[model samples]
Target chain A: GESVGLHLPTLSVQEGDNSIINCAYSNSASDYFIWYKQESGKGPQFIIDIRSNMDKRQGQRVTVLLNKTVKHLSLQIAATQPGDSAVYFCAEVISGSARQLTFGSGTQLTVLP
Target chain B: SQTIHQWPATLVQPVGSPLSLECTVEGTSNPNLYWYRQAAGRGLQLLFYSVGIGQISSEVPQNLSASRPQDRQFILSSKKLLLSDSGFYLCAWWSDEVYTFGSGTRLTVV
Candidate 1:
């Protein structure tokens, strides 16, 4: 049962606006892709990766968009602050499996003020 | 500068008791170790993984168990402690470009 899901459990931006978090994957040989940033208690911070041959990848202000036809994966946060809120994860790696990482179903970004 | 450490950040075992969770990695060396679990809000749940020292790979088979003697060390065991084993416990390492997590261990199986 290969699964990695997230269609937005929660997300709200305002600070500087511009934010988008959405992920949907079921593993189609998943070729490495990651985006993580979890604050609340820390642990899980590495915010940009894409390697299904590469579709898009940018860091600093964050940006990762990979749509292997439709597996879909996106995370873009340009200005939104408030420490950028919290929880945001999307991971998938199964191209010979370097160490296995299949995460998703997490999106709770609340930045407003 | 690489670092990853997981310990008793919080734990309160009970229900049959018996469990150990510890992961260590510093500056990397033969790196590639992971153990993740998260419940409260869901996501991140890839049980065990190791690439050296004794070698282990179990993506969830229940009861839980994992160990990687040394070489950055990694261990997660359980002989009992059910109650769904509470939640939150992460330890990761794998850097070609990313993945470095620790500072998480909050079990509570009362």
Candidate 2:
């Protein structure tokens, strides 16, 4: 009963440009959301997270925006670098007696110099 | 200050063979452990999770099974490998807001 998807499968951006990766979740009851970045041949790493009550949260050079009304979550990276080239995934934490996290199809971000 | 270790970075096993992947965590106690499988170009699918030692919750029913023998150890196994079981397996630990992951194991059941 949980589905999360991305608008695009891959995004190509030039170096130093700002990159925005979008995600749409179907579950509105999710209490928290997190964005993860996965590099080739490695496990995913946490980039940022946002609670359902808040609309936006900022970390070093990245930001997470949550729109509960539309069940949309987005990750914005400033000054995209070559090192930032990776697959990004958004996960929504369904809260209750059991903690279930639903992950969306990742968007592969390719930074071109 | 928590870290996870997953071994056998890559394995090529034949069908009908037994499978075992190990994951261990350090610097934390009683952390939540998870086993995830990722097929090519697909999102992570949660296979099993353990809240504590001997407390395992399975999300999906398949050829695989998980075990938590110790507080910081989680293992995923199967009696006989299947071709469908070949994929990238990831081990993770969650505490507080952040979830840290191990280097992952790539299993190829041929």
Top lDDT prediction, candidate number: 2
Computed on alpha carbons, the lDDT of every model, listed in order, comes to 0.86, 0.91
Tell me each candidate's TM-score.
Answer: 0.34, 0.96
Which residue runs does candidate 2 get wrong by more than 4 Å? none
Candidate 1 lDDT over residue span A38-78, tens digit each: 88766788878888988888888888989889989899999
Native contacts present in each candidate (fraction): 0.83, 0.54
Candidate 1 deviant stretches above 4 angstroms? A1-16, A19-30, A34-51, A57-74, A78-85, A97-99, A102-110, B1-14, B17-36, B39-45, B48-79, B82-84, B88-107
What TM value does model 1 have? 0.34
Worst 10 residues of 1 chain A by lDDT: A93-102
Tell me the tens digit of each residue's lDDT in model 2 across B1-110: 67889989999999999999999999988888899999988889999988889999999999899999999999999999999999999998887666778899999999
Tens digits of lDDT, candidate 2, A9-80 = 999999999999999999877898989999988888889989999999999999999988888999999999
Question: Judged by DockQ cut-offs, is candidate 2 incorrect, acceptable, medium or high?
Answer: medium
For residue A45, give model 1's deviation from the true position in Å.
Answer: 16
